[model samples]
Target: MSALVARPFRLLGEGAVRAVRTALMQAVSAWTADWGLAPALVDVDVHRAWDGTSARALAWNHGAQSNGRRAWLAVGPDVATGLQQMMFPADPSYGPVGSATPALAAAGALQALDALLDALLRTSLSSQHNVPRCGAAVPATSWEYGSGALVARLAFGSRHFHVLLDGPAVQALVPPAAPLPALRAVDVAAGVADVPVSLRLQAGTARVGVGALLSLAPGDVIRLDKQADAPLTLASMSSHPLFHAYLGRCRDEVAVELVQSHTPVGEVQ
Candidate 1:
């Protein structure tokens, strides 16, 4: 006779699930701030299924009901092994009270999830290695609550993020490509306009022959062809010239200024 080996099972209780949702909201706030994303309004709650399955969902609401705008981002678990799921409402009939008209750019939900996940990784957070594949499915009707269209599945620790389209939505827009690493709230100041810039293409004279040979001396000087007052160039990830300013200290922290604009990064001009 052979004995079967049993595995330990852990289930989330009502109190524990509620606490987890609350913690997730805090995590979301930190993630947006760290990634320079327009912070999202977070709402977390616990949902249960009649079949004894229950889980918590994190909802990022973006829409207003008065203007027919409706869009939301929801992540929770269904009536199964407590895996995670993402749902997007495409129809407007069943909309949230203050939801804004959904926008096309909101389709970047997949990317947004990636940004949030990356932030989690940077913060050294561990997730269960049970992330499933991402996929989407469309519900039969707009008025049917909890109905949606699935787009695709994303891979998390053991769960995947799926995209769904059911209504108009707004997206957390990324700041236009800039020269500096990122734009900060303190970047905006009196007499300064926040713009993007990059120094990649700004032509710089390179050492060819004598400039290279003169470097052999211990105290040799190799002067750059550009003038010292020629607004020192700054760079972002794009082509636009953000702002030209010298670094300064504010409240014991280093800061920059948008002194002038040459060319807008990521823009035709």
Candidate 2:
């Protein structure tokens, strides 16, 4: 029902878009943390409205595999200005931090942030995620501000920046994230097997009289009201039920054959 709805990459599933947003947030947080700022990830939202004069966009080809496919990531003025203030001190004299203009601040801040993001992409994010960035520092004079722009709002405290990318740009750069935790399950399974397992055979239970407990001595037989067909419960050291089994013998050794899966009360599995 909006113009951004008509954009190309908006059709990319939430996972892909979320991965891109997460990468941006990580870059932003790392950049801020280096400056000694305790930035928190607040929210990431898709926005169609854009009201800013400063923007920095880069067009890059994703190598030969993409047949020279080009895409861009644009930054809005409000966001850039916010980052500039948060990143450096607000010196009115323009001494150490440079100028005070939003256009200049946004451009410079974005350029610096781009370098940090590049390093992150090389390290944690990598090519599998497919995020994009420009080679050199983008000048403030290069920004183009207009409408119909798709923006992503990365909010941290009072900081807010819009990542402007066309639908096609996102679809090209963003890669599909693995659908699961995606670690080495085989290693995990092998380690899990080595862990010690314990079993319990609570044949039956009774609320006996205190006199009966005190009278226990050698050569005394205590009869428990247990049916022979009743199953025994297998449990972990932590007392978590693993399975239900029936009493039996495997040739020479006594055994309790598993009969059914066990689920604790209020637990689905």
**What is candidate 1's lDDT per residue for 193-252, written digit by digit as tens?**
455434442324546597678567788666777665565555656645555765555898
The collision pairs in model 2 are: 9-167
Report the number of the highest-lDDT candidate: 2
Residue-pair clashes per prediction, in order, are 54, 1
C-alpha RMSD between model 1 and the true structure: 26.9
Q: Kindly list the per-residue Cα lDDT of model 2 for residues 193-265, writing each as its tens digit.
A: 5766566677776677899889989998777677778777777656677788988899999888888878754
Which 10 residues in a row give candidate 2 its minimum summed lDDT?
A: 59-68
Query: Which parts of model 2 are misplaced by more than 4 Å?
Result: 1-10, 41-43, 47-69, 76-80, 88-151, 155-159, 165-269
Note the Cα lDDT for every prediction shown: 0.38, 0.52
State how far residue 73 of model 1 sits from its true place (Å). Answer: 13
